[model samples]
Target: MLLCFALSRCAVSPTGDKLYITNLYEDKLLTLARDGTLLATFKDPALDGPYGLYVTPAGQVLVCERLSFSKLQMDSEDRSKLATLATRERDGVRYPMSVCYSSTTTSIIVGQWVNDNILVFRVE
Candidate 1:
C-alpha cells in the first residue's frame, strides 16, 4: 500500500476560496484552491509535527507544532515559509493540538493535547 498523506487538520481561508491543511507526520502544509487544485506546499524548517491550523483575516496561516510547541507563521506572499512567533509564553505550550484566532481580543488561542490548557497570544 502506498501512503498518500498525513493530513491532520484543515481550515478554510477568510474569503472561503482556499483551504489550508496541516500534515502531522509529513511536517508540511498544503494549500488547495476551491476547485481542488493544489496551490502551494509549505515545508518550513520549524514545522515539527504540525497538528493545528488557523488562518487570519489578512490571509495568514498559523501553524501549531505538537513537538516544538511553537506557533509558526505562513504569510500570503511566501507560501513555503514559516516564522516562529515570539509573543507566545513558550513555557507550557506543549503539544499544541488546535488553534483559533479571536478577533474580539485580537489574540491567537491555542489548545494543548495533553495538559488540556489553553494559551492565548496577542498579536502585536
Candidate 2:
C-alpha cells in the first residue's frame, strides 16, 4: 500500500497570485503558482515538521514546530536556524496548533491544540 500526502496549511501570497503551502513531513514551504505549477521553495531547517505558518504583512514567515515547541523565522535564504522561542507559562496546555498576528502586527493570537481556545498576546 502507498500513502498520499497533501497540503496541511496554506497562505495566500501578498499579490494574491500564488499560494504557499507547508509540507509537514517534507519540512518545506512549497510555493505554487496560481495555476498549480511548482514555483519555488523557501527551505528552512527550522521548518522541521512545521505545523502552522503565519505570514506578516511585511512578508515575514513564522514557522511553528509542534514537537519542538519552538517558533522560528523563515527569512533564511539558506534555511538557517533563527531564534528559538521556548514555551512560556501561557503555553502550559499543549503545543501550538496555529498562530496569527493582529493587523498592526503588535500582537499574536495562538491557538493551542489541547486548550481548544485562542490565546492573545501583546507584542513588546
Candidate 3:
C-alpha cells in the first residue's frame, strides 16, 4: 500500500529487510515491508515530534523526540515502549533530531539540532 506522510525520516532495518519511518507531523512511527506494504503504526504520547529512527542489531527501535528532547526505545515486534532512554535535563540531550546505533561500539549517537553538538552514549 502507498501511504502519504507530511514530514518523515526513515531508517532501514538492521537486517535490511524492512523500513522504519518517523512520521514527524503525525507523531507516529511507520513500519513498512520491503515491498512497501504498510505493516504497522506506532503511536504514544511520548512520541512528540518523532524526528529520527534507528534500528539496533537486537531489533530495538530508537526514536528521537525533537519537541521533547528525549530518546525512546521500543520493541520492534510489538512497538511497546521499552524505556525512555534519555531526557533533556537528566541526560543533557538537547533538541535531539537524529539517532543511530553502533553495534560495533555498543553505543547510540545523537545529533542535537539546536545545540549543534553530537552526543554519544554507551549502551548499558
What's the lDDT for residue 20 in model 1? 83
Candidate number of the best TM-score: 3
lDDT (C-alpha, whole model) for all candidates: 0.73, 0.62, 0.75
Q: TM-score each candidate.
A: 0.82, 0.67, 0.83
Clashing pairs in 3: none
lDDT tens digits, residue span 1-124, model 1: 1145688889988899888888888888878889978887777666788788888887777788865444444535566544566323555567778788888899988887788678877876
Q: Model 3: per-residue lDDT, tens digit, 21-107? A: 887778888888899887878888877888877777776778888644334344345666777778886787777878888878988
lDDT of 2 by residue, 12-98 (tens): 656666676777777777667889887777656545666777776766555556643344344324434455553545455256778
The TM-score, computed over Cα atoms with residue i paired to residue i, of candidate 3 is: 0.83
Q: How far is candidate 1 from the true structure (C-alpha RMSD, Å)?
A: 3.0
Query: Where does model 2 exceed 4 Å of error?
Result: 1-4, 68-93
Better of 2 and 3 by lDDT: 3
Compared with the true structure, the alpha-carbon lDDT of candidate 1 equals 0.73
The best candidate by lDDT is 3
